[model samples]
Target: MNRATVSSSLPSSPSRRSFLGLGLGAGAALALAACGSSKGASGGTGTGSSVLKWGWALPTSWDPVFSSAGWDVHTLSLVYAGLTKLDPHGAAVPALASAWKYNADGTRVTFTLRPGLKFSDGAALDATAVKKSLDRGRTDPKSLVAPQLTSVKAVSAPDPTTVVIDLTHADYQLPNLLAGKTGMVVNPAAFTTNAAGLASKPAGSGPFTLTSYTQNAKAVLRRNPTYWDAAAIKLSGVEVYPLPDASTVVAALQSGQYNVAQIPGSQVEAAKAAGLEVQVIPSMVVATLDVNSSKAPFDNPKVVEALKYAIDREALLKTQAFGHGEVSYQPFPKGYAGYDPNSANLFPYDPDKAKELLAQAGHAGGLDVTLTTAVAQGEPEQIQAQLKKVGINAKIEVIPQAQFTQIIYIQHDRQVAVDQFAGRDSAVQAFQVLFGEEGLMNPGRTTPPELTAAVDKVTRTPLDSPDYPTVLQAATATAVRSTPNVFLYTVPRILARTKSVSALPEFTVVQRFEGVSVG
Candidate 1:
């Protein structure tokens, strides 16, 4: 069977449309879409072969429904095309679906799929396939996306190319929400035949197909000729290897074993000195101190406020991130629509103020607390030292990184801990995960009524509406003022690659290789 036959004559995508008009669309829809190793770079095919050898962590699971790690969203995207993809600006654009529109009041959204699309296995990727994938996302007991799809009342397929999503309330954020794992469509037949096997084998109509995979080690992919916009794909294939150790990245790149890798901020100078092209891309990652407000000490609002003021964000940025990031006051990055400028100095570093607040909270003699962490090297130690000056003694407790979330997030057995937040696809989604009552980061499972109201307003506003930014910023302010978390800094994703590599873009802070080339 010839793979090219699936989309031998599909036309180019339609033009950009506003959220109020034909719906959310961007330039050349379905366009643009990493990681890691010490393996031979370029697969011995030379630079012109367009094969990317990347040093990055591999996904925990290929199937989006079963993948528990939010960080895996970008890696999984290489094999599964979501209904909507994000633009460089993090706006929702077309990918699998050519165009989409919402009805009056925004309760329902209709997506029109590109015609004659096929999975790598030659299965039709039509509206029915989308319905099946979305239904499973909300109904499957093992699905990690069920929580994100609660607003989705039902999904209906009216025709081969048409899919209508019925929402429980006005939700203009669905397009952005679908730009991540929740929107990735999988081959129904593959999961039906062997659901458990999907952890290794993925069947999707994406830009690439899984040619070979080794769990936690390596994954090789070949470009799918049947992809809707195959002509836009410049790379013949992509090879990824898990290179978690930051110290090894520069050596791997300089040794010609890896052409592209996510190096740590500390390695930035080393990579540049080695003549490697380094891209310090602004990211949504926030290194934060999560305070469980339900627990003693923090249960008192003054205590939480004191902890906030005690954090020296500038010092943390220089020490932990090596001055490669900005001091952050909220979950959203600066210049993003959801970021609030007024909150930039919300909690100025004031040890005296923190001490006064502590006394006001009835801890006049100083307080003792536990600072749990998965990695106890850089920031955790700095944080512990800073708090001591403000009369807060923090005992460092280390836990395995793998079990940190389960213990702190799920089990709610933590008082305060250092954690990294990988931002979500949508601003609203980020707020829900960071501040919602049941948000994974909210160990205490509490949400202030004002914060909830502000976030809800963001959902009701259209993505293209002039009022959207204000609504999102309003929500950010609410969360900043009431949330029980101290955001320390925003770390940029430092990508070290050979000069030959170019066009590597990031959407929603996830590195994309689509339209990228090696030579």
Candidate 2:
């Protein structure tokens, strides 16, 4: 990692100032002006023509360990490289490390560094660097990845190229998370505790180096000449602009002020009409209507069971997600290990059954509650309508994304929240997040006895052992029947890029920026 002093300033380049003046002046003369000439496919014919103009939201913090501000992990991926990376098929592929192997018990894993690999600053990317990066991820108090590595005992380097990750217990999900933002390696020499010092210049081994960045505004990156995979490198530079508004992003894509951007699903058609390409991938995210199990009107088992029977998962998918999402009744999605289809479809929509259960629970007339959500796009109204049919009155409460955790968890003011979380490769990851001892929605922050024992058994059962599948299925089924959360659906990942971009691969977690070309 380059630990040298960073340049405080840089020369100016082209600007799209008019795009900033967008306002909803329907009756005034504040209409947006015409867009400027397009940057041709052939690197604009010169002058950093190979620069890929990419625009998206900027992360709140520049610190890699604590910068998990929504989907901003994609931005960090461009500046820092991980040990393992996900392929289009969700399989682990080598990045900084060439090859890796695991022990028979799945308690220890070893990785071999790719020879001749160097950071942007000409620093060695050997086993020592790998150990430091993994240690930071596992031990950093503020690190988001630390929770995922709770089972990891230590990260060590035996030789120059050999790196080892020792686990206290078996974990199949650790490697995949290491291949993602959780595993993004930062050069220790270039790193600073201060956010600005680190953001001023990120000395990573990625395809590009951060030249300049303004919080929530723009970032300019120059190519890293020492990139290991030359064939994957296409753009000489990558410029990122953060326009928070969805309407604004769509407008920029339509007018050609920006080459590639991620737009909402509703705006997919608009982008396609403007001659841009679109790809809708199924993201590993699941939404749920969380209930305060320890609170009144919900503490009763009948109430929880009734809430499960009341929701119309399929209808919610079609009405809210533009029919691009799939129904998710369990914590983990289908095709993942420990997933049980029988559990996923356990609760069907039966308004009569829901009413009967409520009556039996001593709430025959109805119960009034609040459904808090960050999304205001008719989701609240739709849910309000659905619950009303089951004799429950649901009021909508709109909260900002940042304030949701504080209000729901700390303050305990939000009785019910329509929230979502990322699903991992192993079903245990999802189960632990929603029902484990320290889970978000678990009552009193304590795991249910049945769920706890089931998860424990799964961890003890080796992956290759015949009992592994049986124990995993039991855990998933128990959690599903418990109904700690009313599993709803997983939203589709929708992105819009210019037609000039020849290759854009699908993403299971975060969007990938590698192997992209302007021509």
Candidate 3:
């Protein structure tokens, strides 16, 4: 958010020599080396002792409004403070806005800003800035979060600190919804000059300011001294490197390249053996098979139903996730409010029934289709073998991880792909992104009428009502019975960090860095 940091040029896919030539510093070079290395990094402490080197995926876009990936919400959270933030229990708490109250009918909500909040640009980040961001999120054609704010009729700032949001109907999901990407406020001055430039140059009131960034390599951030919650942020700086490879995670953490890093379930023991503290924290993420309903094999309802019964969720739990996952039948996890007990075994593994359904659908000889995925993991191969048992011959097509989002979410060309959905903060928003007409994961862009009506009941019901959870479960049942997405298993986020680092809380959504410190 500092002008000096913002003015720094962000180079794309530069060679090692060219990267250092940019003069970003030794930290940038260490991040690149760590990112590209399979073996341990050239040690001797990559960065300052006060700086936390984190190994994680780089955000697809820096701007929350234009970001296509759901996980980007966490990375952007470092630079942009939202109106509300979620506690460890996933409940909404105040951040920029001190407090908020809804009207009697729940059709309007008023938020009171904390006194004297300022953006990195030294501009007033008051009610007017919040209104502008909310308006843009709802009205901007390019905003990926627009679907979550369709019910917002208008956003108004009556005074310097009072912001009001008028909704078309009674909706109680706003607080939690705002806690995520939709609630993050951007500097109006920066966006007005060049909206697209905000993707690389961010200006927010979050705890950290981007000092330097190189695409697919690393992002170096320095502490924002002016952050409203400065006392909570302990790290002087943070160096983030994109290390998506699970195999390299243990080595990276053990070699002092990354003090904390996300590892696969299989690597948990390895991390523990290396004297690193491990936390296998439960998450709302569900690995599912995204089926294009408008496509060839899936157009037939019977074919879609057949594939649902074809998969063995238990086998996938053991094989694909190495028993670090729970077999799931719906989008919401088992303990979540939206999970439906009745729908747990709606389409249990029954190859005979699957074959019968295929025969009835005039595909008795079987049908050939593609199982596309970005990662070359055992899950897709396992799914391919299982589908073959029910006469569904699946050819696996591996696409580059960089192009996966473009092909599946943007271009909508995938027939059936393996995707892990990092569920949203609100169940209503999660449903919209999974089964709604404009959902990013729904490549076919099709949703059943039953699902739409069911989710509507969830939004209208107040969160305080006892019937709220029931309506949510009903919607889950509808989605489970009607949608083509095959729920496989729920896996926890496995993180390995040094014993010196502490205070990593268990968050239901993406990982949070607030209060995390390296002692």
Write down the TM-score of every candidate. Answer: 0.90, 0.83, 0.88
Q: Who wins the TM-score comparison?
A: 1
What lDDT does model 2 reach?
0.67
Candidate 2 error regions (>4 Å):
1-48, 192-196, 199-201, 425-427, 440-444, 457-474
TM-score of model 2 vs. true structure: 0.83
- Local distance difference test, each candidate: 0.79, 0.67, 0.78
Off by over 4 Å in 1: 1-48, 506-508
> How much RMSD separates candidate 1 from the native structure?
8.4
Residue 177 shift from truth in candidate 3, angstroms: 1.3
Model 1, residue 39: what's the lDDT? 32
lDDT of 1 at 243: 60
**lDDT (C-alpha) at residue 2 in model 1:** 20
lDDT of 1 by residue, 429-502 (tens): 88878888888889989999999899899888887777888888888898999889888898777889998888
Write one digit per residue (lDDT tens) for candidate 3, span 470-510: 88899999898888888888978788899878858787665
